[model samples]
Target: MAPIAAHPVRSAARTTLHTVTVAAAPDAVYRLVADVSEWPQVFGPTVHVDVLQEAPEEGGEQLLRIWATANGQVRNWTSRRVLDPAARTVTFRQVVSAAPVASMGGAWRIAPEGDGSRVELLHDYRAVDDDPAAEALIEQAVDRNSTAELDALKKTAELGADRAALHFSFHDSVRVDGDAADVFAFLDRADLWPERLPHVARLDLREDVVDGQPVVQHMDMDTRSPDGSTHNTTSIRVSFPDRRTLVYKQLRVPAAMTGHTGRWTVEPAAGTDGAWEVTSWHTVTLDPEGVRALLGPDATLADARAKVRHALGANSSTTLRHAKEFAEARAAGAPDGAGAEGARATT
Candidate 1:
C-alpha cells in the first residue's frame, strides 16, 4: 500500500475539547479509552473497529481502521494510537481521512479526583481544503463524537469493575430445510416480533437510509418477564443483506446488564447441502448492583449468570424455531394457517 499524501496543515486548523468527572477509578476510565474494540459498545458513534497492527510498546499501542456514524453519516478512517498507562492517557493521529477531513489527532486524559476520576477528551483537526463549509462540517463531527464518547465512558466506568461479575458469551443455532432469504427476512422484520414471538410484548422500530439503502435500524423492545411483567430496552442494529447477518448493540440495556451485544446470522448448513442454519451469538456484561436488586441479596454471581443465560437463550431459541417453521411452511407451499398468522397479519 502507498503512503497517504501529506496535506499541509493550515494555521487556522481548529480544536475541540470536552471534559467530565465521574465516580470511577482512573485506571478503569483509562481502560475504556485505550481499548478501541470496546468502543462500539461504549460509544454511540463507533460502529466497528479493525486492528491493523499492534506495537510492542510499554502501553500496547496500535494502528486501527474504524467505521463510525457521525452527524447522520457513516464514515471510516485509519488511525495510530499510543497508550500511556502511568499517565492514564491515550493519544491518536488519523492516518487516513474519509473526506473533507485532512488530518485529525487527539488525546484522552484520565486524572485522579477526590474519590473519583476526571476525564478530558481533546481533538485537533484540519480540513483538506480551505473551504469554510468543509471546516464547519469537520468541527461538527468532532464535537458530536467527543461529547458522546465521554458521556458513555463516564457511565461505563461508574458502573465499576464489579459490573463484569456475570459477563459471558454463548450462541445457539437451528437448522431448517427452507430458503435462506426467507429466514433472514423473518429476522429482519423485527416490527412483527410482538405478534410472532409470545415473549415480545411490544416493539418499536425505525430505519435510517443512506443513498436509498437501509443501513441502520433502531429498535425499542418490551419483552415479557417471567412474572408476567415487562422488560424494556433499546438497540441499534446494522444489517448486511448480502451476508445475511444482523449485528446489534444495546443502547439501553436491562438493569442487570451494563452492556449487551449480539448478532443473528444465517447461512447454508454444512454437508446437509440443502438446509440453512440460523444462529444467535450473544454476549453480555453484567452490573453486580442490579443483579443484587433483581436476584436478591442471597443470589451469587453464578446464580445471576445462570438466570441471564437461560432467559436470553430461551428467547432466541424460540424465535429461531418459529422462523424455521415459518420458512419451511413457505417452502412447502402450505396454506396460511394459525401458525402463520403473526407473519401474514403484519404484512
Candidate 2:
C-alpha cells in the first residue's frame, strides 16, 4: 500500500472589534477618521503619517506610510486605504507590515446614533509562521492601541461647537546662514538645551539607538515661562535624519492644554548657497476648564486661543533664533565647542 500523503496546517486570522459611542455627529466623526494626516494628533499610538500616494477624487483609494508605537516599541508599515464617504466607512489593508505580523487589515465604521455617533473599529491579523507568542503580543498591542484611539476620538469629536476654537496650529521660521545638518544637530541634541537656551531650566533626555543611530528620544524638562514661573513637560521625539525633521508629542502639558505636538524641520534654502531654513510648527488642543482656571472665569475661548498663540510662538521664535546662531557660528569655522560657549554667553 502507498503511504498516505501529509499536508501542513494553516493558521486562521484573528479578529477583534472595538466600539465607542461619541457625543458628536456621524459626519464629524467620519471626517476625523478619514483624514490620515491628523492621526498623529488625534490618536495616542500614532507617531507620524506620510501619504505616499493620494487619490484624485474624494472618497477614493490612497496609500499611506505610518509610524506608530506598538507594545512600547516603534514600528512602521505601509497600508492601502479605501474611503467611502457615502457609507461612512474606511477600510485599510497593510501592504508591508513590520516583523511578527504576517498580514493585517482593518475597517472603521461610523453610524448615526441618537444625534451622536457609534464608532466601530475592526481588525484582523495573522502572526508570522503561526507563532503563538508573536500572536499574543500582537493581540495585546491591538487591544491597547484600539482602546486608546477610541477614547481619544470620542474626546476630540465631542468638542462639538468649540472644536475650531479649541484646536489650532501655527509655525515660525528663520533663515540660517549655515548648513542644514548643523541646524538639525542643534535641534536634535536636547541634552545641551540647558546651556544653549535660557528658558530651559533643567532637562533629562534619554535616547534609544539602533545601529548607532538614535531613533527615539524621551525628554523631561522644566521650562521657564516669561513670567518667571517654571512648567514641567514630558515628551517623546521621533527622528528622521534624511529629511532633517524631528517630530514630538508632549505627554505632559500646561494646565490650559489637553494636547500638544510639534515639529522641527531644517531644509536648504532654495537658490541659495550655504544657507538653510529652519521652522518650528505647533498644534494644540485647549482644555476649557483649565483655561478658565488659568486666565480667570470670565476669560473666553478666544482669550485662551490668543494667549496660547502668543506664549507658544514666543518660545518657538526663541528656539529658532538660537538654532540659527549656533549653525551660523559653526559654519564660520568657529572652534568645535565655540557655539555652545557663545550661546551660553548670550543667555
Q: Choose the strongest candidate by TM-score.
A: 2
Write one digit per residue (lDDT tens) for candidate 2, span 209-319.
Answer: 756777788899999887778999988898887888999888789999988999999887788886888999999988899999999999998898888888888888999
Residue 244, candidate 2: alpha-carbon lDDT? 86
Provide the global lDDT of candidate 2 against the true structure. 0.88
Q: RMSD (Cα, Å) of candidate 2?
A: 4.0
Evaluate residue 159 in candidate 1 and report its C-alpha lDDT on the 0 to 100 scale: 68
In angstroms, the error of model 1 at 144 is 5.8
Q: How far is candidate 1 from the true structure (C-alpha RMSD, Å)?
A: 6.7
lDDT of 1 by residue, 175-216 (tens): 999877778878888988898899999999887765676657
In model 1, how large is the Cα lDDT of residue 315?
Answer: 87
Per-candidate TM-scores read 0.72, 0.90
The parts of candidate 2 lying over 4 Å away from their true place are: 1-8, 210-212, 270-273, 338-347
